[model samples]
Target: MSTKIAACAGAATLAAALAAPAFAGPAYTNDTGGSFRWYGQFNPSFQSFDDGQEDFNRLTDNAASNSRIGFWLEQAYGENTLRFNFETAFGFRSSDGVNQLSTGDNVSWDRTNIRHVDFQFDTARYGRFSAGQGSMATDGITGADFSGTGLGASNAVADSAGGYAFRTSAGALSGVDIGDAFSDLDGGRLGRVRYDTPELAGFTLSTSYGTDVLKDANDRESYDIAVRWANEDAAGFALDSGIGASWTEETGKADQRDISGSFAVLHKATGLSLNLAAGERDIAGTYAYAKLGYKADLIAAGSTAFSVDYYDGSDMVTAGDSAESWGVAAVQKIDALNVETYLAYRDYSYADTSAATYQDANVILAGARWKF
Candidate 1:
């Protein structure tokens, strides 16, 4: 098996092997044991655009939120429990019908990945703490709002001139997904510890602290902190929001700060949901995305959903310039097949470069996926 598949499978086996015995001490009691879960997805999309080549395919085991797939291990030991996850996957693109894999596939181990060898421990009075490679915990919103369209990796805040072209995919590792989501901040893997308070009635609170997993020569640490609240879903509607920041001090870089916040309210009744998010990066500038969508009862003998998204990131600071972009898509589910089509456009400009000042780009996507 390939390294990717092997790692993914090994992680899964470990999670299974950790299961408690059918009958045992306090740790294996019926009240102290929970089950394990495996989740996955495959999203392969095609495209046609105005800038880059048209007609391409991209697949990720985890889509919907960011095309992520992994197994979650949750065990109960009285009032406290523990959880862990692991996943192995890569980013792929296609043109015509050819699968064009990138060379970075060798190490995308950290790109668009959901499981980063992480673990969470919980105790009734002590709250919960999680550590390992993980996302900075805060308002739970950053970059393109998890559009699952790869908004920040290959595609970030597009300038007003070029626009943050939706034609470019951002996935999790935006740069490499575009230029290279594998290096530096492509889902920059670091150390994170999170503490979650016990839920009271219908509300709970959480806080986290994190550090850069990969440090520069100077050995400075990137600090992350934030808090969030959540309530049990009510009448098919749920809400999530939070705020936090990232700061680092080192030799080659000035200690910079990033303050980000976002809120989302979801309703499942009547097949509809709206997502709105906006955030600012001290170094990335600023980026925000909004989406409104609905699942139709039926269309052409199949179930379907339509949605539109708008993005703005001209405020992002770059050595070159900035960009802007937009995207729209419709997904249809037929029998066991799910198909989706999308179109995107971007406009970009240069602030310092003397060469071509701008580029107008566009892309169209089509994809059909099935699962076991």
Candidate 2:
């Protein structure tokens, strides 16, 4: 364990020394106020997991923010604007895909990897409307954080080593994996039509109806509604919050419903922040998450951020089940190089009404993200 830590530290130091600066050029604009641009980022990491009975290590793409590329086009007409967006992942081996039996599986390019292929129209007074494959109304309602450490830490606990299963006290593999017990209950993208009301006093309302269009699975109807707010006070304090509800139903299946929300506040002067989130599923589960964070200009390169978070969940996988997790992370920004390097550690524990006792699992991740 000591040797692995030392090797990771050495590799991080070498990466920092060899990092090069990269930047994106200005967008191309026409005489009629139309513009086009391309963007992307790469996030890769070295991860280690200890599942009580065994240890595992691998180099994989960060599931929090994987490598991706995108393009955007926009045109303006008076107070209204029309835009199009297209984004997709690079299909690399992911951190969450590795496990005790396999190192990892490199995903191939497919329609499911396409994040956004949508068109939107926005007006100053009437609000906005969107169509095609894109985020639903409640997409980010459960992930409000201002700590600048989201690349390494967030409300989602399963993104680190979710595939690894817990071992029983008798050194046998437990059927449950990390992902099965822990979830943020966040909304996702789909082939949908959405509408957002214009901001009024820092608050906006949104709604959407969609389905799974990228996959060939059983089709289910999904609907979502959400409200969001953001504001800054005279004392240099910033606040962001959002709440949302979603429902899904399919033939011959039980209807699934969930409500989730999150709030975050930051004091610019001190660079201290707090974030909280909670959610409940109609079927039979609840989860709450919290994080305390601090950031400072301690380095000439850019800002440095640190955070610690905890998660408590009940009845997520089955009745009488309890899941708990905690993690700490640090991120350093290199503004000149358009890069951010991070290190994070997390521990997960699970319990249930069963007679068998399950052991804990822990993971360590270190990596860098380069944006351009």
Candidate 3:
């Protein structure tokens, strides 16, 4: 290689060597308790339809707001430190295959994009606080643990489990985007405050409250409160689980309520993991989730994983005939990229016989996401 090329290679290696420790995971590690990390990720996926019924044939297919990219920065300082997380996803999209374009085109995005943006600070003895437009604290974002980068069967559990409902209740103003936390699921103009207690052995607790400023004419929305307690790292077996609830105050009548809970267990020596999540949506609906997963590191990349999940909900909880569903998938990581994917089949049951709808629907998506 030329002298210039060798020089450039040397500089790149030196830079990576110097930057590695600053961005490693877990801000407070060991006695050092200080560092910074910066990382970005990109994921894009596509779909092909085989909708044999309803003349669902079309021209082109695109993944809509499914593509994403962004990065995060975190640092620790003594008993107190600072952290910043910024991320965004493809805002909105339209599909082009067999009339699917109409479905994708209507999904408009106003202020919501995928790059989740937020910053956090630790008050040490006081509390840890987070601010900015970031992930919704609703039951789903806080409780749902579906492995994929997309929403899945976890919603059924989050909505029905009573203590972990995925934040899909009242603040729902249909006039906005799809994923906004307060408006739709896309994005919302809101702020959140979270406080966590220091852990005692394998136990800790947390509570969070949030709402959108533009929600009410005064730009003030209802306050959603969440509480979680977990027990873990006991004996040599590790386990973590907790429950939470959210309530919205109405002007006159009783308040709307959502509650949810989840638990995970790991047999460290055997590499076995199991999880269960449940949610309840007021008097309107219910949700439950059951899953089993295994981790084995015999391969070159060290570890591989597999899992299965099932969920059931009330009639109004999910649309159609059965309101019951299940999904399964696996993941393998090699070097800079890990390939993971999942597909779920939903059976929607109907309460009214006079309705016309697709009795059974299926969704399948699989792809790879890379980070650097």
Candidate 4:
């Protein structure tokens, strides 16, 4: 097996081995026809990085969501429904397959970030409201995606090499952070209360208020509002679009605000897709991203997609510093194996030549994803 497939399969096998004994019984069910089901995903990838001075390889978790297992519970209430979901997972280093629960090997192996633990009430007519830890209104609305290229090449550059360091022409480690400087501010999920309005003529509105995860001190809080329009496969075309704004305030600290939007369109007949996203932040200046792709049944029993994406961020690092990122990628889906295999190449460069520590970098990523 290729490195990608091996890692993907190994992660799945390990997860299954660990989860099987823990989930031996039937899922909880009630008399009201409510049911619960378990679901999970395992994605492992291999990335090669060239910092313009030296090259290295990294075996890591998925650049996207990592590996996870969760449960969904549903309860019927007349025409409405009450739902609860719980999910938790952790990342493992591919190089050694070592599971590091927490730093300092602390007194308690209190590892793992609780990704989601929420309860939702959905009304057929009114809308949906959710409480507990979950995504806010603008969580994923701003970084729109309609192409398969998100696995390796997207506006969120951290997914691929979240820990990699940049090397300068002098062969010295650059102090500038690579992940934040080159990547866009993908929205974050927080412990929040959210309300989403029912779809009205392909439009929906949502709002949320959240306290920071861990309930940090200094009275930290966030609020978000978003509007989205979606019409899938209507008149041989599909559209998904959203716009959102957010504010974060902390007593005695600089308040941060952001405005972000994205649109994605697809031609059903030709399998052609286009996506664009733009955002401005109080600290990170402004950034824009665009992608073009085409999907076709080029392989028997599979669909293949080719795409190119570009991103430009002005003053992304500091005043008068800008970053440019571009990539080309291809993905092939094998339905028989229930796997998606991808290969992608991306380049990163900064425009501030005055800084001796800033330099160009190149990255290549290959990965496979299995979702169940």
Alpha-carbon RMSD of each model: 10.3, 1.6, 11.4, 4.8
Per-model TM-score on C-alpha atoms = 0.63, 0.96, 0.64, 0.86
Among all windows of 10 consecutive residues in model 4, the one with the lowest summed lDDT is: 100-109
Off by over 4 Å in 2: 13-26
Which candidate should be chosen as best, given TM-score against the real structure? 2
Shift in Å, residue 304, candidate 4: 1.6
Per-residue alpha-carbon lDDT of candidate 2 for residues 216-290, written as tens digits (9 for 90 to 100): 976888999999999978369999999999999988888999999999999999999999999999998899999
**In terms of lDDT, which candidate is strongest?**
2
The collision pairs in model 4 are: 63-159
Better of 1 and 3 by TM-score: 3
lDDT of each: 0.44, 0.90, 0.43, 0.72
Compute the lDDT for candidate 3: 0.43
Better of 2 and 4 by lDDT: 2
| Residue 310, candidate 2: alpha-carbon lDDT | 96
lDDT (tens digit, per residue) of candidate 3 on 242-332: 6666665545555656666776667777767667776665745555667766667657753566667766554243333134555554554
Better model by TM-score: candidate 1 vs candidate 4: 4
- Compared with the true structure, model 3 gives a TM-score of 0.64
Q: Which residue runs does candidate 3 get wrong by more than 4 Å?
A: 1-37, 48-78, 92-110, 114-117, 135-189, 213-220, 230-232, 249-255, 317-322, 336-358
